[model samples]
Target chain A: MSDKIDNISVGKKANVFFDGKCVSHSVFFPDGSRKTVGVIMPGAALTFNVGAPELMEITAGECQVRIAGEPDFKTYAAGSSFKVAENGSFEIHAKDEVNYICSFGSD
Target chain B: MSDKIDNISVGKKANVFFDGKCVSHSVFFPDGSRKTVGVIMPGAALTFNVGAPELMEITAGECQVRIAGEPDFKTYAAGSSFKVAENGSFEIHAKDEVNYICSFGSD
Candidate 1:
């Protein structure tokens, strides 16, 4: 993974969720696809609803994640990734913090 | 300003400060200059040290700001902005979360 994403349009406003436990900004690409660059604060576990298939790429920090229908929470650290299906949901916990790039419709 | 900033490269990693009270992503322009899109959470007053001169453009929410050398705090709302000189500092308080685009070196 690269350190930066080049040539994109990003919204000025941010998406703050769970009382700021999760925050993300929308990024738009030339091909019309979109993604979000976000940071999840290490706090109480947070559940995320996936509208489309998503590929969560962790760039820094660590997280324990459990996808819907999955029986266990897996650990993902920097340079690691995981996926969730469309219309699914997941629970994530970060003991410190998690910086991620979330790609939608990644199926 | 427009709802989005186009044709810019942004770092995947974020700049999280004040225990996540202030979070920003760095955006690079083709001209080699850089800016940040950030959110100031509603909580305590936060002081930001300026490296380059910065123009803080408020996109949403509200804030009371006091630039260094200034006597009183000024209120800035959506569609408004404030400037800080290089090497100076400023203190801001947001009763509600403030969403902003900060353009640097705008002198």
Candidate 2:
């Protein structure tokens, strides 16, 4: 929920996904920490596979997320964060353009 | 320099900078490409040291940049891109809150 970050480097090359539904860039910190800042355009639902644990925070707009096995989807908006376990998968639905930051953890 | 990037995962932590002058998150692609997307606030100019070559693109607002020994600073607006040599330094001046995506290259 913090609005400030510092002391990191970025990666070269753009990462495109879902036929252009999402786009993001990588960020690296001095202590080896990393995260991705991106925007998701309004459209259909998206399913994502998690390799490592992740913390997804919505910076703008709103969306609903359904974690695997969850009975109901939870809605999130700007300043909200949700966690996804390693090897877990989640489905996201956004009605409007969504800007977010996904932070991967060591697990 | 592209507006849309996809298929990338993000890191787990936020990268903070310059005593709250900037903040960013990391993004990772399935193919290992990485980048950092961030925002720089308006204030005093700041100098940065580069470990690798960097391509800085302004996504919102505008800023002035001085790459190392450049005689004068250059202004960049949204959709504009600039390059910084590996191991080189650069200075940035944002008149207002400036949103940017910086891509790091392996020289």
Candidate 3:
């Protein structure tokens, strides 16, 4: 995977959630696509509600993730990814400080 | 000030600091310059060491900042900015969740 996303527009401000347990910035692609680059604090277990289908690509660290309706929590590590359907939610527990890029709108 | 930075590249990974109290994403400019978009958690009082002189521009929220060699703390709010010399440090206490862009290099 590319280390950086080029020629895109990014919001100057950040999107803070979970009282700062999760922090992310919004990146806008020229093709009208949007993504978020984020970091989750270690040992923080949080549930994220998805508005669209999302592909969560781990760039660093590891996490245990359980998508809504899934029976088991799966471990996702660096270079790994998981998908959540639109209108769904997922619970994530960061095994370490997890860095991830979240792509929305599709599986 | 511009709400979004266009035509730049952003790192997929986040830079987490202070036990995840501070998180930022690197933005690379075509001019070979770099900046970071970041958020500081509310009630967090932290010090950041500077490698190069930096301009810290507030994007949202508010904070009180005391740059090294300065005797007093000054409050900075949205659209405001401060400069810190290289090899120096600054203490910042967020009044709320603070969103800022730190542009490195001389003022």
Candidate 4:
């Protein structure tokens, strides 16, 4: 296991592994696991697929999370927590920019 | 497993099971596992022992986390993440009433 903590700045990106799948631009823990926390600027969007169940908490601002093929997006505000199953495809859009943390099981 | 999501208010308390010890006032996910997110007020203190390694992210404010018998305390600021091993004793003090999220593995 890689125990490296990486701090990525705005406009920069990193890759995180979730059960062998790659989630790009994911802020990782020091252990190089799938768990991460970072800020997402307004008008920004990210898409990825998770291989294990995932949990996220909206710490600041607000964002819209849409699961693939799902109608109607979910609005996540500060202090909100939600879960996504493994192998679920997700896309996140920041309405006015927001910061959130995401964690998932290790491979 | 209990897949219930509970919303807790300030000055309120809840119990979370880590391994077998009771960690009080822990905000849990909707799925009802150890993973949680909540706010810790200033001057407020909490003590608990985790059974699995924990990952926490400070979404707002600042606080001090001190492990049992540790000489000095570690300060966590907004946008910072840290880990605590399972079975490790820890105490958290909000320097000026901060809000943060704490998550851990299930039993």
Candidate 5:
């Protein structure tokens, strides 16, 4: 792949994918795709349930993630890196509106 | 691997790596490593020479990259993603102080 950075723009669509939120945004693999932005509003959370996942740095605000049977939520801030297991389940919550990018593949 | 982002800090060191700048910062692979910050200063450029390279988003300022005898430089701003070939040589230049992160592996 070219070493050039790819620029992507997300317009004014305040998009959020919640538990069971499976919307195809970009075709990452022949049989899989990714989401541009996943938001967790005040008192909101999401449980992801499939695919090989990769997350970009949290660009703004903060959020909490609970993975597997983890007791406490792991907090993350902007400019932080995150990844997800292919068949794992995790919940994400935010005190305010938070936005992030996620990519997935089915290999 | 855990989906949590690994936190790293570069304490008080204004580090820059130029062509032939090979410094091991983090051990990514058993036999390979990565560099945390690569700065290309005003009127300065770098040519990366080895490894499986993955760059984090440009975090500050701006820079230009020339690859494979390409005529013009690819300008990248903060939050842009970039990757590098395992054995390819490319040149980078900046008009001002620019900083970025690069990760590499032996695989």
Candidate 6:
């Protein structure tokens, strides 16, 4: 993310739901933008249902991801990002404690 | 952070102030606890005047830190944590894009 966009004020708290594989915190900005930054533990797989457009970025570590309708899982590493459409679902297999940021947009 | 603490419901948004070296998002919980997760860019140095006791953890990358009255800065890397007393000030030199979590306690 650009330093300009990151310079905004982050609003109230939000949480990410996962059994034990991942932990995330929601960040809202004064411009009404929101994102979540969290960690995904190693050797775990998780599937999530999305309600809006989501952009998932890997900040640290690596993971294999299978977004809905994909034929096979693909590798994503630090500095990589993928997008999921509204109402889509995605699966993730973590290889390490993966640090990530998920940005949501109305789309 | 443990999975249980990681499972927390992250509350409202907060912003961190820095010229261009770092960006952080504030996280609040229902229990009135708070934290901020952020990134410190490479080769940047910053000093902060803290009002409460703060526990800072390096989740990714590396940094050299000098807490108040500390004779020298210590190098810290991933999974390392340090504490700062209330009303104390600290300086940091980032060697990379350092990801961290700063947890604050009343005392």
What TM-score would every model get versus the actual structure? 0.95, 0.51, 0.96, 0.36, 0.36, 0.50
> Which lDDT tens digits does candidate 3 get at residues A2-106?
899899999988999998889999999999999999999999999999988999999999999999999999999999999999999999999999999899986
Q: Tell me, by TM-score, which candidate is best.
A: 3
| Overall lDDT per candidate, in order of appearance | 0.91, 0.73, 0.93, 0.54, 0.47, 0.71
Instruction: Give the per-residue lDDT digits (tens) of candidate 5, residues A1-107.
Output: 22111222111111213321211112122232334433344556667664565553455568888776678788887666567666777777765545455665443
TM-score of chain A of each: 0.95, 0.90, 0.95, 0.62, 0.61, 0.85
By the TM-score metric, which is better: model 2 or model 4? 2
Per-model root-mean-square deviation over C-alphas? 1.4, 12.2, 1.1, 15.6, 15.3, 12.2
Task: Give the per-residue lDDT digits (tens) of candidate 4, residues B1-107.
Answer: 11222232111122223211212233323354544444444456777676787777676678888876688889998778777777887887767535445678632
What RMSD value applies to candidate 4?
A: 15.6
Interface RMSD of each: 0.7, 10.6, 0.9, 16.6, 18.2, 12.3
lDDT by residue for model 4 (A6-68), tens: 232111122223211122223323344544544454566777677787887776678889887
Please give the lDDT score for candidate 4.
0.54
| Per-residue C-alpha lDDT of model 1 across residues A1-107, encoded as one tens digit per residue | 67899999998998888888888889999999999999998765999998989999999999999999999999999999999998999999987779999999857
TM-score of 5: 0.36
True contacts kept of 5: 0.00
Model 5 TM-score on chain A: 0.61
What number of backbone clashes does candidate 6 have, counting pairs of residues 3 or more apart or in separate chains? 12
Kindly report the root-mean-square deviation of model 6 from the true structure over all alpha carbons: 12.2
Off by over 4 Å in 5: A1-107, B1-16, B19-35, B69-71
DockQ, structure candidate 2: 0.05
lDDT of 6 by residue, B1-107 (tens): 43113323342222424533455555555576767776676788899889989999888789999999999999999889889999999999989767788899864
TM-score of chain B of each: 0.93, 0.90, 0.96, 0.61, 0.62, 0.85
Give the lDDT of residue B82 in candidate 3. Answer: 96
User: Which order, best to worst by lDDT?
Assistant: 3, 1, 2, 6, 4, 5
On the 0 to 100 scale, the lDDT of residue B10 in model 5 is 21
TM-score of chain A of 6: 0.85
- The most accurate candidate by lDDT is 3
